[model samples]
Target chain A: MIIPALIGSLPRPVSLSKKLEQYYLGRLSEEKLEEAYREHTRRAFENLRRAGIRVITDGLYRWDDIFNPLIRFIDGVEVNGLFKFYENNFFYRSPVVKGELSLGENPIPEWLNVALEIKEEVYPGAVLKAVLPGPVTLAYHSINEAYESLDELAEAYAGVLAELMKELPVELVELQEPALAAELSRATREKSDSVSAETAKALIERLEKVKALWVVTYFGTPRGFPEGVILNFDLVEGTLPENYRGDLGVGIVNARETKMERRDRLVDKLKPLLRKHGKLYVTPNTLLDFLPESVAWRKLKLLGKLGGE
Target chain B: MELQILPTSIIGSYPKPRWLLRMYSLYELGRLPEEDFREAVKDASVAVLREHERAGVDIPWDGEMGRSEMTEYFTAKISGFKFYGPVRVWGNAYFNKAAAVSKLEYSEPLVLDEFRWIKANTTREIVKVPITGPYTIAEWSFNEYYSSKEELAFELARILNREFTLLEKEGATFIQIDEPAMLNHPDEVPIAVEAINRAVKGVNVKFGLHVCYSNYNLLADYFDEINVSQFALEFANRGFREMEFLKKLTHGELGFGAVDVHNPRIETPEEVAKAIRKVMKYIEPERLYVNPDCGLKLLDRSIAYQKLVNMVKGVEIIRKELAKEGKESIPFRRSA
Candidate 1:
């Protein structure tokens, strides 16, 4: 009865002014932000632990952005200016991969160092989890300058991330495939003949190289989930379509709301499903602008109960 | 024949009242003086229903005026979520992004106390209560709960469905499930549609699904699977292309967003009229209704008022044009 709990990044709430100041001042010097971020990350983990969350993550507090640092690991890829995704958020743009792509001096060691520090200081005894944006999503969202095909870029990204995963120290790795569900159509639209099977195969192959992989998909459907990708993973994490097979991670709680009582029923409904999957994970819907600490703790308690921790 | 007005369907957008702004500011500032904020929000909820009634809006939304962020309000009420901090908006629309927050639980069910309050205050023909759809809730948030995003969305949908059922029992005639994120991630349409349908399953009320501009090129095909009666879409600000798609999709009444609520530019009655006339060519006048593209929160009170006024005038102009041509008058419908 081991239910999976959020051992991944929970959003960090920093005011706009602070975020800007930090971003502009080049204050991302590990020593400065790391100390404060580690403290914040410790508090988040402690809260989850107290709420009975069995697994934990550093909340990705140390990373300036999810894509940039990793892009630095790939050789021949010039980091371009950051693009503002929609509003206040931003991500680094990578130059196109024209030729043979390979990993530069592995930046995984630096990432792993941060993960290890968070594990040591934050959620000391809890199962550590690491989150990386899925390769397909990264390739899709990134600007492809010199590449003739997205498949080529995706393949390159897969190799880079897989290599990074091999070097990182963590019990479980959650590769967020959010873009897969929603962006698949775009991928198909852009490269109709080469999108689906190619993207799915590339993802599945890359995921196989990792030890404990949870291929997480969100926002839209990845035409290949239950049929294409999920079967290949160690644990298929996400709210599965009613028709999906294997394990279940019932995401019944909403991250935007301030309440918790509504999630209780979600836990109850997921119990039978969890039994079928051998384990279940209760998660909040998504990270939004406001979530009261009390509600988060309650969700962790439920996950703890389900996991028999 | 009095237009055979039997209320064939329902649609509307979440109305963000002025008081909700104050509450959000307070909550964002981390000084919500507890009792005061709650009382004000409750009052704001009542005001939302009243405003819709005054505007003759078909489906009355509680305006989502009571909550700071649509979904965060509930998570805060529940015990699992932790208040991480303000949400960061990406670019110029930075102010529009509800401050960032985080959650940690998925064990408690949402209580419909606010819904019950809205239900108690209104005696209107049919109140259309709005809830943030599960997919939008999941996409908008920083997820830490489940291993994947879909799982999180589905779980939220289940919870929302429970609330929706309860609201229906409490006298809601329609539910406008808002999911703007659907535009950002079109691939999740099937998953979102399923979650939404599941939430409103067995509930007898008319379900009005509202999705904003996320490249609605495939809207015709997408609408074929969703079981909802009316698709109250944001067409005006996004453009007239979506209307053509809706016309081809189905003959069902479309709640066409006629007002540009996002931009501060107040559309004049003439401009609104011209826009309506243009869209009416594609959509039968009888099956169209005027509304703002999305919520009015982003606009100032005067701007929203002008936008709505121009919208009503636009509809009036279209009505006159149809009458002159011996066509049937279009009944009023809500928009997102």
Candidate 2:
């Protein structure tokens, strides 16, 4: 049955965040830090299950934030150059591709293992989702000194992602391409439509082994994409009746703001639209990490009430 | 013979003790008393001042000890500004944003207590007071009262003017208005400049404006009109990319940044010297005051302290060489 699912990255409590920062500064041990970070996944999954949601993500507690760990795992890409993350105060380290971009051996699977442990602990054999940046978002964010063109860079990213997906045990994976939104870059405005569509199609084809491939667009309304996998647009771009057919992840909650919403109100918003689609999953429009931890928890509970069986 | 080549100064705010942050949180949660909070803040300011003295900063400020943020902290002190809640900056990082619901007023000089503490604790004759510029305070905040952003900024400027005027009257030698948002809102530079001019009105102290992580080329035309004695800007963060922008400045000396504050890799004295050499190409050493690219709040205390030490060491390397060449630093100027 259709249910509530996470886009990725649950809100990290400020105390935990401070611990992580301290870990980076060598004030805390690796084992203790992992324990702290991994403990949150248990709570995240527990909250998910209580919300009557089966499909979930690890909440990426270990990820130094998205676009990191992923780009840092690659050999040729040096994590340099800080770009403002949307209008947010957070800065993402831009991947500077000096040479060939290939995935290096890392502990990403181990992170997945921690989440899988939580899955086994409570909701045994439930679908666990993994979120990664889409090829377009990666190539778009990168400063390429080696690649001949952006198209080539996107292709390289696709090949690496396919490899990662094959190795990981995630039942579903979401590609977050918020950069497809125009405000990020002017070049995105003029070129993203055609280039991103091609990139998304190419990536979807490459990741044939993954159980489900979802391309989630946030921040901007993408005009269109080539048909392949489930396309999840944010509240701004997502609607019912006309667009819903195969499947839809209805973003019933706004993730950017800290306003708590009622479950009944959300269910009402989705009730009419849910029937139109062959499958529908309710979700927040973007990462819940932007909101306060308490507010995020309340939103998750709201999902439990509305998206529940 | 010129003044200390690359006279070192902080871009305000040193690494605060973890206890102060904890106490502030406790105070917010109503677990700590006001007297204890104030005492802790004064102690933090004293600690930061001692660190600056040890690092040999020529113009050290009070370290903005009780400041939760540049905007919200000051806004909390000001009348008519109300905070809704914290807004996310990034991973687990947030700054509580305030909205000017009523006309902003300079209810009290909030920094007076901290300034008084700095005066009592430190032996230094001159102390830099870095306040949020009207444009930045307006730009950084959510405006619910003012008709336009320009109007909000102007009103904020009037408030800041009252504060700075008090600081000048109380014998402040150097006052730096931090406008990190200046280049971010280029469309309103003229308005921002006017607001800034209004902020420093009738203040006779050596004024400085701190703007970091920005393209300085954008401010060329507006430089002379900014009404400040110094422009403290970041260079090491951009790999010293915009060094040529300094030559376009018609007024104000340069508060050149040599250390990269955001990076944990403590830059060597040689690395600091190399960055200063690039700045020397655009402006004379006499007009240069070396500092870090930005505040070292994000960095660890050890890293921040060492970077400042290395920055001073780097300036000493060049200073020694200049002395060998029969050039000595002139007496430090209180104003341009």
Query: Can you list each candidate's DockQ?
Result: 0.07, 0.17
Q: What is the lDDT of residue A266 in candidate 1?
A: 58
Residue pairs that clash (backbone atoms under 3 angstroms), model 2: A51-A304, A90-B89, B2-B330
Encode model 2's per-residue lDDT on A1-309: one tens digit a residue. Answer: 357777777766666788887987789999998888777777777777877766678887766567887888898988875555554434567788898878899788778877888789977745787888887778777777788778788888888888787777776788877655532442111122234565656565566455468767776676555255676767744443375354567677777554466666776767666655646777788877666566677777776566543
TM per prediction: 0.52, 0.82
Tens-digit per-residue lDDT, A1-309, candidate 1:
654467334545453235435755586564665566556666776776676676555565544455556666677576653332321122234344545567888655665566667667756777776777777766666656656677777777777777777877775676666556645333122323243565655565556656576666554344565332322121222335556675445455554444344446755666666657765565544432224344545555655655552
Ten-residue region with minimum lDDT total, candidate 1 chain B: B1-10
Off by over 4 Å in 1: A1-14, A17-309, B1-33, B46-58, B77-83, B92-111, B119-124, B142-148, B183-186, B242-244, B325-336
Tell how far residue B166 is off in model 2, in angstroms: 3.0
User: How accurate locally, in lDDT, is each candidate?
Assistant: 0.58, 0.75
How much DockQ does model 2 earn? 0.17
For model 1, the docking class works out as incorrect
| TM-score values for chain B across all models | 0.80, 0.95
> Which tens-of-lDDT digit does each residue in B61-169 have in candidate 1?
5656665556566566544444444444432122222222334444544546766776678756556666678777666655555666677777777777777777767
Model 2 chain B poorest ten-residue lDDT run: B327-336
